[model samples]
Target: MTATAAAPEEDGTAPAGGGTASGQDASRPVRQIVPPEDLHATELAFLAAHDSGPRPPGWRLTPRSVVTFVMGSHGAALTLPDDARAAAGTPRRLVIDGKFVGDRALVERCVVTLAGERALLLVGEPGTAKSMLSELLAAAVCGTSGLVVQGTAGTTEDQLKYGWNYAQLLAGGPSPAALVPSPVLTAMSRGAIGRVEEVTRCLPEVQDALVSLLSERRIAVPELAGGPDGLAHATPGFNLIATANLRDRGVSEMSAALKRRFNFETVGAIGDLDAETALVRRQARAALERSGAAFQVDDAVLEALVTAFRDLREGRSAEGWEVERPSTVMSTAEAVAVAGALGLAAAYFPGDRDVLELLPGHLLGVVRKDDPADAARLRGYWDGPVRRRAEEGAATWRALWDLRTVLEG
Candidate 1:
């Protein structure tokens, strides 16, 4: 009935013991389950055995379950039983963390592309959760997303292929011990997901390392003394997922060959207001709890904050009044931070002044991060849309326009 309500089980009954509140006569008390540190290959194997679809080699779940894991499952809750949850020594629920927040279709495309043995490339603006999505996808399929190469201006070919252990190479003369595998090579050996973040940030030559790896499915280490095993061939379910920031356009472009080798998916910003508000609320509460701070902000306040963000971000009011969007990204992350700030303000200031009133100021501060042009953009939003809405007599818009001085100053 409510958003926070516990969804019913398959048998059309409430979850075991009716609710989290258990009576003395009940078998066990309910406990909340948190995710574990590492999701191992064996653990993946077990889940795959029970998983309901055709699984690819080395993958724990079918592509469907893998999607459910990253996007969350609503059909059947995979929570631990109450008794199991309460048992001290018993293992907790196998919680799959969903790091990405956008489309189910995008996630499915990424998974499908990987399964097809194609390198997957995620392209998106800054702060669009491109890196986070890659990490979750890798973790879900391979049981670990730890094998990562952070691509930057200084990224080298050795970082993509392999580097020799200097001491071992000198003494033992390029044996297996001397052959140091890069994350990509390690994933190839283990049949796991290898990640390259900000791939476009790397120089053209460095980016070319991926071209050979994807097409040939092996890395040639000439320094290792040529041998059959010296060329690392991907076993199975081994694929690379790389993210490139669209905002960083001209930094370092990938070669045509490298680009052609990968299937690309573009991630977009949050478009749903309610979803964005809930995301902000969830993250704000989590932040407060993590810091041992109490949360008391009202839902209406959060809605208003999200609404303002959406309006400024899209350069239009909900009813279609025109505004100018700032250059800064109005990501869900920024909304979460603004909500957290309001919560802290409420805790400290303790006033009747509505939290929504603090939005324009906080938003101005967020938008005016590094450039004066962004401040001008905020002014344009106020002068155009805010003015129009105020003239049309929307009380909330009028009040927000009154606070335009906050941005101007």
Candidate 2:
């Protein structure tokens, strides 16, 4: 079957309906956050046709293409050959934009792990895009990114393994028809990728359920034992991609046995200043676009915003001056959010206040999240870096230095 072909139901039949479960109007308002699969469907289909190389079983694209899909084509346009161009809904020429702005090698490692059918664990700081990478990888590998379990303190083993429809069970008495498969179980049966976000947040016992599933690659349905639907075996491409935040390390630590079942990759913040600034701009602009407003934040203001975040994040200035790091993470994701707020402020309240004037307040808000003392740390940052930069006569830093009172309040 082609990459775009609709997947069959667990019972090996095409889905009955052509409409949504609610039968909501198709022309009604769309979702705020579209899934990666639907958002980049065309790119996936194009890449599938673009590369006819050997793919791992049950995979939509070759492993190499999966990496390219995540890291992008690096500004080079990929032209679909004449034969492949005729495939419906795919553009003849397209430049795949980079989604995750981290190391290419890290993405490659993730793809390789999935290709090998081993569970992949992405551990990172709270806002380092681990979930985004998981979603993108799942979307690229299996043509769908919807198979996911959001880990939480309330999470249960049933969420990772299986549950049952109580009414259906009462009617059918433990039949396969009564089963409600978890996202992981469904992925096992269909050879798709399943994601578990913030796995560390789940209770330790609830999290341990994955140990047997990852090792054995099958889920046993004891209720249906000796029947045709007794056990659900994993299809060839079945794999799991889980994300955990570094900040949540001790919340529900994984057992050594459970940890051994997966390949762990640590995703870190973007290292390059220019790349981070560009990403902040791109993400902020996307946010503004979603809100139906133009992105009017200036480049100099964005650079200054990013610079302050980096200085605080790294605990040192670009000029090698010491900075007292705050207890809270000054992540790039937070930077993007602040930039988006600035854009909105500029678009909605033009000339009400300079956008640059709003930066310190936003930074103060971010810094004060974990501890109030961090506000003092932020003030110290201003008294140090802001003071030095202003003394150096850079106009943007001088403007920020003049607004130290914003942080004071």
lDDT of each: 0.74, 0.87
- Model 2 lDDT tens row, 1-409: 0113433345433222212322223455555566777667667877899888899999999999999889988877777776774457455666676888999999999999998957899998878999889999999999899999999999999999899999999987998888999999999999999999999999999988899889888889999999878989998999999999999999999999889988999999999899999999988987787677889999999999999999999999999999999999999999999999999999999999889999989999999999998999999999999999999999999999999888877
Q: TM-scores of all models?
A: 0.80, 0.92
**Candidate 1 structure quality by residue, lDDT tens digits, 142-190:** 8777899999999999888888889987897878877888999999999
Winner by TM-score:
2
Among all windows of 10 consecutive residues in model 1, the one with the lowest summed lDDT is: 16-25
Ten residues in sequence with the least summed lDDT for candidate 2: 14-23
lDDT of 1 at 181: 88
